[model samples]
Target: MAEHAHTHTSTPSPVPDLNRNRLPTLFEVLSRRTLPPVDLFSFYIYMRDQQRSVDYLDFWLDVAQHMSLCRHYVRELRRSVLVGTPEPEKDSKRSSAILQGLGEMSHHAGPSMYATEKERDQDAQMSAFLREDRPGAHDSPQSSNGPRNRPSPGISSSRDITSDSNSPAHTVARQDIRASAEKILYTFLLPGAEREITLPGSITQDVTTAIEEFGRDDPEVFDVAKDYVFQAMERDAFPGFLRMKALGNLIPATLIMRLILGLVSMFGGFWAAFILIFLNETRQTRLWLILPFTIGVYSLASYQYSLDPILALLGFSEYTPFNFSRVREPYVRKLLAQRAIMVLAVTILIDAALCVLFILVPGKRL
Candidate 1:
């Protein structure tokens, strides 16, 4: 089952293109590669710094290493068990040697280890049992070499032999696989894990069930959980990662430009409003305040918190940041675009309302 277990997964499991000649990029990994150790580790660090979720990557890396461990244990068990069948003649000789060792320990010669009283009692019991059973069974069953027992008639041909599920080899493999499965279950899937990934109840229950069905009972243990983690990272986390990574790569010159733009928009609008209020001889102008207020609010808030939308606003996303995705993060950018349009419409309506108010009812100087 362990041998067959791998044959199923081997075909679809393409090794991620590491490209050791160049430094690994999260873009390539998130785009075309499976989660490898290095990329995942670096991503884990990035996420950790941002205080984002890293449990998924943690569990993914652990499960991959455990799968390798399962294969290793299975191979070791198979290699060790495939030596040869036991012979009755050799068994009898080994038994006789053990008996001789037990009998002669009391008075061996100059230098010898001593046996305990339990061994003496066991030796006495064995002597009595052998005297009763072998007196008439064979004239000289115990000779100088050893007591001889009849061996098997013949060895079975390779084609005639079949592997038993109850055999020692299978037993050890099951134990190894089950142990591996249990570690995964308790450490990540089960409750009270130090690094537990967020999983639905049904998925958790399925993986728990898989632990009980280790080996041939359930060859695809943790497979569903693995896919879930991978899909989530690929769909949700990677997009945000790509965006953040792009933001992280902004040039000092670009950032200085954004800073200058934000400052000019914010302060320039504020001073313009001050001058308008003064020009009106301290009569507060409502209609003229709308654009300045909008510019000031957006400039102050958008740089840090709303960076992606701001980058798209500055048109950097069309080139550097959005190079990976042909779709251009429509979900996030689209939502932000709607909000921007709404703000624009609201600003215009407010300006019109203030204009009507000023025309119909002029304000006295404050």
Candidate 2:
């Protein structure tokens, strides 16, 4: 039992929120990631739809994927190194191009290797189909039973060329690492990429220099750039993500109930204040109106007091904006929330004043 438990136990996923295993608190998302995170899809939606600055998340995930690929290649390289299997050499006489990875060994026979000029021409024609140039009507269609139709090469053979190559393990590993790093740099670090991260000039420069210097087969080539992007998202983007999830998690049944209650708490005072100030009817109505408005006032006040933290969490300053980064969607949302609460305050106060007037100096009964 102990051995089984030990063997099965693994590190917790960095993306539990994405996996839908558990939801972390706001503090965990913000504070915890600094030490490092998100529910992947939800956070992406929040950044994309609400924050309007999804490049932060996009760049982060891109680097994460690059890192994962790098690690995978590294593991495969290590295993191959341990096994010490000398890779096989290709037969030069075989056909050069392949539509798919595998077929009858005869299909691979080169046109040059055939016995006769007529057969060589035939082999060349068939080789076109094998070269994946599209398999349809041709000058020489195969005999009815012959292999005019080739089956799909299964997934496992996708890497057969690489697996059978004469190149040493290090050469393949180097190419994989170099290709991944260049792609990351092009997609994110380049000056005008479609989805660039826009790091500080120094940070981006450092990444370029590091990749140039020691990136060959180095899995951590992008670590520095990754850290900067992670910090940017952690400090600025993640809070809004947490709020989005919190609000989104409320089911329709629960949401409707909460909205009903929140609306009462939000606007009940204003509704009563309208009744008192504009449609004053009687003493009893005035007195009764006062109590609800008073409660509304309290609720709005409390919300207002707590609102600063919530706004801060929404990247209010950045969007408003602290960095003067292009102002965008979530700022509008934050502003709307603040204004709605202010309106509630105004209405509640008006009703409270009317109530005070009625109590302190009784108006004539109407």
Best by lDDT: 1
For all candidates in order, the CA lDDT equals 0.42, 0.41
Error of 1 at 344 (Å): 28
Regions of candidate 1 where Cα sits further than 4 Å from its true position: 1-38, 77-177, 213-219, 246-366
Give the clashing pairs for model 2.
99-130, 317-322
The number of the candidate with the highest TM-score is: 2
User: Residue 159 in candidate 1 has what lDDT?
Assistant: 14
What lDDT tens digits, residue by residue, belong to model 1 across residues 52-140?
66666656655544443333333332333333322233235443443434331121100011235653454344333233322232232
User: How far does residue 160 in candidate 1 sit from its true spot (Å)?
Assistant: 48
Query: Which stretches of model 2 miss by more than 4 angstroms?
Result: 1-46, 49-51, 81-177, 209-217, 237-280, 283-361
State candidate 2's TM-score.
Answer: 0.42
